[model samples]
Structure formats: structure tokens, C-alpha cells
Target: MQQLNVIGLDQQGAEKLGKKLNKLLASYQIFYMNVRGFHWNIRGERFFELHVKFEETYNDLLLKIDEIAERILTLGQQPQHTYSNYLDNSSVEEAANIHDGRECVESILNSYQSVIRLQREILSAAAEIEDEGTASLMGDYITEQEKTAWMLTSYLK
Candidate 1:
């Protein structure tokens, strides 16, 4: 008998997607903290603008983190929640003491690249399994993050 998850995705494919989503969730956690640090520790001429932008970025990450966790649950897998787990699983490294706005934005852009790449992979996996829910989520994230990367790149230029 073929097993399907709650959303009718094949269990094996859903499990693979869940694992990838968990990794993404971990990256998002680290990236969220990094953005919070940027919001709090940002210095120099663009302080006012970058500070608010970082806050908005982190807030958006927070929402995505929740959505990712819930998606994992919907896939019939547990979402990893511990900091240790996130640190171990995440590709994005922690950014510490980034006082300069350019450096912070660059770090953000780099992290977005990592996330966007992983999300693209997940999108492929979801598409293979006909998982429209996960595919749609990744599509939305990729589009938004790509625009953000472009804007940040422009800021640096």
C-alpha cells in the first residue's frame, strides 16, 4: 500500500521535503538572529534607515520560521526547535558585532543567496512530488528574497 501524508504527497517525498524544510528553518533561525543583531548594532550614516530595515527583515523571517515549522508538521515530521540543532543544521553562519551598514547588508545578501539556493532545491523536490503547497511557499520566498538581494546589491554599489 502506498502511503501518503496529510496533504496527499507521497510519504517518502514528503519526508525528504520535510528534512529540507527543517534545514531551511534552521537557516532562517540563524539569519533571523543575525538580522536582529544588525538592527540593534548597526552604526554609521545609514543607521536610521538600515536599523528599521533590519527590524523589518527579522520580523518577516520570524513569520517564515513559523510557517516553515508548520509546514513540516503538515508533512508529518517534527520541526527542529533547539538552538543547538539549528546551529548544526543551518548553512548560514552567525553574524556578530556588525556595526557597519554595508557589511551588514552584504552579510544579509550572502545569507539570502544561501537560502534562495536551498529553497530552489526544495522547490525542485516539491515539484517532483507534485507538492504544490511547499512549491508555492518556496516560490514566494525566492521571489521576495531575490528582490531583496537586488536592492541590497544596489545599496552597496
Candidate 2:
């Protein structure tokens, strides 16, 4: 007999979803750290504004990281927790020592694009297996991030 997860999802399908979520979690972790650096190191005349914004962004990313990790656990799989694991699995690259506000916003926009694309792919996979929980989460992230991207782009202009 085929095993199922606590939520009644097929074990195989849930396992695949868990792997994908772990990758997303890793990317979020890298992106979170990058934004934290941005928050700490950002300079320029816009320092006050960008500093607050970056703090808000990283805080939000931290929440999402926890949620993704919890979801992976709910799916009966372990999340990638270490920085090394995050580096290995994440598509987002680490940003270091960036102080310029424009540069930080640009880097953040790029990370948003990467994550949104990945979430869309995950959304498709979740939909294929009728995993509405994960699908809804991806959809929400995509929508929120798209709005954030637009705002950041305007900030650059």
C-alpha cells in the first residue's frame, strides 16, 4: 500500500514537494541574509529610508523562512538548515558589503525575480498533485513579491 502524509498527500508526491520547498527555503535564507547585510551596511543620502525598508524586508523574509521550514516538516521531510546547505541548494547568490542604496535595491529586485520564478514553478508542481496548501502559499508569495518588486523598481527610478 502507498503511504500518505499526515495531510493525506501521497508520500511520493509530498516528498517531491518537500524537496522543492527545501530549495525554496534555502534561497529564502540566502536572500534573507543578503537583505540583512543590506540593512546593516546601506549608505547614501537615502540611508534612513533604505535602512528601514531593508529591515522590514528581512523581517518578512525571516517569517517566510520559518513558514517554509515548518511546511517541510509538516510534509515529513527535513529542511536544509545550515548555511552550507543553503548555499548548495539556493539559486540566489549571496551579496556582501554592498552599501549603496541603489545597488542594494537592485540586488533585492534580482533576488525577488529569482524567488518569484521558482515559486511559480513550485506552484505548478503543487497544483499537479492537488496540494492546495503549498499552491496557496506559492501564490501568495508570488503576488506579494511581485508588488514588492514593483515598488523597489520605482525606488530605483
Candidate 3:
């Protein structure tokens, strides 16, 4: 069998980073599901425009979900994929039963902020444990979610 290629992570540090990574992954999954809901249910005076915009936004969030899931696996953890896991693990709420355009916007903006906060915590954990790779990953997530939340919040105003 090949020896492990991952470098410099002691057991405790790696485990800490893995836990942070799984939380981030779960948050990404929740954000992605919420975006998909808005993409399908967005109907208003800007029906066509918002529908198209939601599609693009949801697609972007979907890609981030994939990246975060794979990052968790790279850290040697299984990704949380089931609805049960999501409902239990996610602080973000489901976007169904929402009828108002501004409501969807508000919910999504909240999700964006939540993910960004998670990213910051992850980055801090990784740095505290001296895991450069996971820290870098969390930094990228922070930037992504911050920019997304800024855009969505602006639209919501």
C-alpha cells in the first residue's frame, strides 16, 4: 500500500480541520438548496429577469457545494448528503413556502452571510492548527460568499 501523501498534519490538528471542513460543507449544501428553490419559484414583475438571475446564482452555489464536499473528503471525512443530515445540521432554513420576491431575496442574503461567517470560523480554526491548505480553502470561500452576499444584499435593497 502507498503511504499517505498529505503533509504536516498531526492527528489532532487534522481532525480539527476535518470537523471545520464538514461544517463548512454542510453550510454550502444548505446555501445551494436554498438557491435552487429560489431559481424555481421566483415569480414577480421581474419574473423573467429574476428567474434567469436565480438560475445563474444557483448554478454558482452548486459548484461551490461540489468543491466543499470534495474538500471534506480530501480531509478524509464523508460528506453529509441526505435530507436528514441537512435538516439536522444546517442552521440555514428551507426556502419552500416562500411567496414574496423580497422574502426570497432576504432569505438568500441571510444564507450568504451565514456561509461567509462559517468560512471565517473555518479559516481561523485551520490557522490556529497550522493547516495552511485548509486555511487557504476557507479564505477562498470567505471571498466567494462575501462577494455573493454583497451582490444579493444590494439587489434586496
Better of 1 and 3 by lDDT: 1
lDDT of 1 by residue, 10-128 (tens): 99989989999999999999999999999999999999999899999999999999999999999999999999999999989999988999999999999999999999999999999
| Candidates, ranked, lDDT | 1, 2, 3
lDDT of each: 0.95, 0.93, 0.74
Q: For model 1, where is the 10-residue window of minimal lDDT?
A: 1-10
| Candidate closer to the true structure by TM-score (higher is better), 1 or 3 | 1
TM-score ranking from best to worst? 1, 2, 3
Clashes, model 1? 0
Alpha-carbon deviation at 38 in model 1, angstroms: 0.8
Q: For model 3, what is the alpha-carbon lDDT of residue 2?
A: 28
Model 3, range 1-157, lDDT digits (tens) per residue? 3233266556566666677666666766777777777777777787787777778878887887788777767666677778777767776777787756788889888887777777788888878767787788778867777887888878877
Which scores better on lDDT, 2 or 3?
A: 2
lDDT of 2 by residue, 18-119 (tens): 999999999999999999999988888999988998999999999999999998898888998899999999989999989988899999999999999999
Q: How does residue 102 of candidate 2 score in lDDT?
A: 86
Top lDDT prediction, candidate number: 1
